[model samples]
Target: MLKKMLKYLSSLRFTIVLICLLGVMFIVGLWVPQQRLLKTVYLEWQKNTPNLVAFLDTFGLTNVYASPVTITIWALFFLNLALVLWQRWPVVKSRITVTDAKIVDPVTASGYPFRACYPILPELSGDAVFAALTKKGFTLRGTTEGFYGIKNRLAPLAFMLFHLSFFLVLLGGLVTVYTEFIGFIDLAQGESFQGELGRYNTLPIPKMPAVGSIPKVSFVVQSIEPKVTRNTVTGIDVKLTDASGSTHLVGINTPYNTDNSSFVFKHLGVAPLFVLIDPSGKEVQGAYFKLDVVKGRQDTFRLGDFLFTANFFPDYEFKDGAHTSKSMEFANPVFLITVELNGKAIAEAPIARNGSMAFNGFHLEMRDMPFWVRFYVDKQRGLSILYAGFALATIGVIWRLLFYRREIVGSVREVDGVRCLVVAGRSEYYKSLAEDEFVRLFETAVIGK
Candidate 1:
């Protein structure tokens, strides 16, 4: 039963079917972004596909790569490839005879698709020919009747190696699906942010076997300097302590790399600090209102039954009846605000930096304009595994393509008073190329005087 199962799994037809299914699934999966949780996917899809939300969730289509069914299919693929490699290992071993082969028929090798016969010099010694083949990368073993000789002796190993790499890639992907942590958090300049899992809105939402422990991380934004030419950050300074209790400075484009986590700058924008004072001389709100111009139709917030919306300009300019900024530099930063209470318009006017407005018993003031930086945090455990797999795959490809496995079978046979050599060669694949290689060998080692 085990043998039958392996045979079925390792069959070429079965492999082709599996690959086709995976290809279709890959196309389908493109509709949903990778590494995002199903909940997030559902939310995004519901905007135009409210009815499909239930279907997507029910079928695990949102997080297709990490879905239980897809993972199982990938696990099976890995297993199948492993079994196939194991089954073919003996064939490779037989072709590369460690002991002298009883019958050497290089030209008739079943795996070698092409064969050739060549003439040789009468004075060419067997040892000399052996030396030439060895120099050209061939391992020779066996007697006349059962000899085995091959160039690129480890070519079969490359076949196995490539398959092994593919398996590791799948396993690595599986590990990433379950073990990696992806989250986004925003921090204002001089604001502190924590790295607790609870503090983050992580993606690909943990499903099975739970996740490994994540390192504790926290950092305070020190300062932000924008590049006025393009409204991008020139640099952002952040101060954090290492595990050794040493201070380190992080900046934009400079990633903070830890053992298992990485913190990289995502973006930086302005945050306007505000103070809202209610009646009875009580200070009600004193905090930064994060103004993200990239978020939606309006940048707004609410405090004490009052809603606020604003159009901001770093270098204020009114051009052609449209709100525009003269430059990214904050030479004359101002904002046009619209305030509403219970859906009734309260105020609409332009306010400069450090400006204030009072209505009834409440007072509102913009104290400072501080830039906020958002860093995307990633916790990865299988990155090394994925890279290792890629490296191995590259080695296997080079070995297989650049140095293909071929064989030359020859023994000196005395013919017509002059002792001459009759050599037959074969190629495992790339028949035409191997034929050319054999011809070169004939001219260089065999027929050359």
Candidate 2:
């Protein structure tokens, strides 16, 4: 019973079922926000939706692939492939290397390509029939008991290669799911970060060994180039320095590739520098604040015992009794600033370009605003394996399409005191076409001539 189970597990139907299950799992994973998201973003999501946080925590939905369900599915699929390959290896390998062909069974030979009881000339011997077959350039691999003719014999390897590539691709994906690291890097135009152990942060909320074998990389944000329309940051210029001291310019979609890491662009938004001073004219707080995470370019922050709120309007408008930005560009920039203390509104007014507000013994001013971009740094250990899978799959598919494997077998046999040559043909695929070609070749090369 166990043997029968093993056989079934290695069958094509079993593999198909496992793959279908994996596909469904992959779709579900996509629908659920993955743990692969930025740590701050994911945490913010959980914080904002407490009920969803409980649900995701209960079933590990946030970390779908790393969860038990997905991992088990992948493991089973891998096992199915390994077993199927183990069972099929001998057949394909032998077909590729076999020099002498043996007679096939009646069941196999009786299919589409066959001719039975073809008469031998009454005076001609069986040896003469084979000599005729040889004259037709059959490339005989037969002893007179049976005759074997083959063309493109090695093409069967395409089947093996395609299956092997599937294994490689899946293995690469599994490795990446388990060990790959994706991180977000934030910087001002002139800011930079080192790629060392102490200088970076990654998503999936960095585990016990924080650094964890990540490749050393460092980069400085140079400048961000704006898009023509609306004048937003479309691309960025960066200077990257690897551990080897090599400096390279990087930009959006143009990542610097190292042995195991890739640095890609992720987030882009605006940062407005603001400074606040007490009534005594002494500076209190100053820094560049990001507005990307805050929807509608508005956010509330607490400083000292005061609550400060900023409402940004890139192109100020009060049309149709609605306060909205006409465009994303800073055409006529305006900020509506409001101050409150202990839930009581102290001051509220719209501040224009080069704006300032003085209220409740504090002075606030907008200094400058600029665009900044974030980079998604990735490090994968099995990228080579993934590339190999793609190459092999392509080669296998092309070979199968262009150079299919086929063979014809014939034998001189006497039945019921009548002697004749019995012929049969088979192909790796495209059976009907192979059969038709076999008949035409045999008739033209031997019988007709």
Candidate 3:
């Protein structure tokens, strides 16, 4: 039963069918928005068609690559390739080794696809002919009749390399899927982050709980600079210092990599520090509120039975009885705030940076506006193995294409006192090119001399 199962799994038909199924799944992946990569887009789809989204998510169709069914299929594919390689090892080994007993008859081998027989100069010796063939990269084994030879003898090993690469690539992908860490966090300038799960704003679960451990890394953002074009942030540059007091520059596309983890910039916004003071002149509560307000959009929060709706204007302007921002760059920042008590508006006004306002026996102060940036941190596993697989695949392809397997059989015969050399050759690949080479060997190695 085990033998039958191995044979069934290693069959070429099974491999082909598995590949076709994976291709279909790849197409489905292109059509569906995966939650991990495009949360906002997937959320939009969920909002638009909740029923369809729920069904797809339930069946794991929404995330095809990481789905249990797809992962099983990948595991099967890897097993099939491995079994196929093992079953074909004898054939590959046979091709790799050349023995004198196997090619004892040069006369019979002369009938090969590429064959030649010609007269040689009497002065030419077996050593001379062998030396010529050696210069042309042929390994020869001498026999009673003549010589049996092969060129590019290692060419057959390329197939094994190809199979090994495929196995490694699958192994790497599986390791990464089950053991990687992906999360996001928001940090204001001067705010530090230690590698802890609780500090992350969003964390995606992995397939397995074998993520090893989180990297020992800590960094504080020193400053943030955004390159704005037409009131839109085109790019963001951040300077940060690590726990070791080393500073590194990170940007939207340039992430800071350390301890096999990468810190990538995702989003940026304004975080205003607010302090609420009571009538007794004592600080009631205080914290930095990172609001997602852009272009005069209102964001609301609750503080001690009071609702505060605030709009942020970087480069504030008061024109035509309306509040607006001239640009997205942080300059002359101000907050247009409306405070409500028991759902009734109590105070509505603008508060500049470092300014204070009073309403209903309470004072609210805008302490400072600091830029906050969101970072998507990733600690990926098995990337080195994946890259090694790619390198091996490339080497296998180049080896197979550049150095093809070919064999030669040669004999020295005498007819009517005229000494002549007979040589025959054949190539498993690139027959036309090998034919030319065969002719050249016959002419230059024997007849030409």
- The top-ranked prediction according to TM-score is 1
- Rank candidates, lDDT, best first: 3, 2, 1
Clashing pairs in 2: 195-217
Which of candidates 1 and 3 is the stronger one according to TM-score?
1
Clashes of each: 9, 1, 0
lDDT of 3 by residue, 1-449 (tens): 99887789999889998999999888989989998678899999999999999999998989988898888888899888888899889998998888876564455764467766767777777577777777788898884258888888988799889779987787787787666777778888889888777777744542222666665689889998777776877888899999999999999789999987789998877788888898889888888888877666778877777788998888889989998888877676889989999989999889998998889899999888878888877787888999899999999888877787888887877755777667677888667778888888777777333
Best by lDDT: 3
- Tell me the deviation in Å of residue 31 in model 3: 2.3
lDDT of 2: 0.69
What TM-score quantifies how close candidate 2 is to the native fold? 0.73
Q: Any runs in candidate 2 off by more than 4 Å, and if so which?
A: 27-64, 98-147, 174-179, 196-204, 207-212, 228-249, 280-282, 293-297, 302-305, 317-323, 330-334, 349-354, 409-424, 435-449
Estimate TM-scores for all models: 0.81, 0.73, 0.78
- For all predictions, the C-alpha RMSD in Å is 4.2, 6.0, 4.5
Stretches of candidate 3 above 4 Å error?
A: 1-5, 38-58, 102-107, 118-126, 143-145, 202-208, 228-235, 252-254, 274-287, 293-368, 412-421, 447-449
Deviation in angstroms for 94 in model 2? Answer: 2.9
Candidate 1 local Cα displacement, residue 271, angstroms: 2.0
Please report, as a residue range, the 10-residue window in candidate 3 with the lowest summed lDDT: 202-211
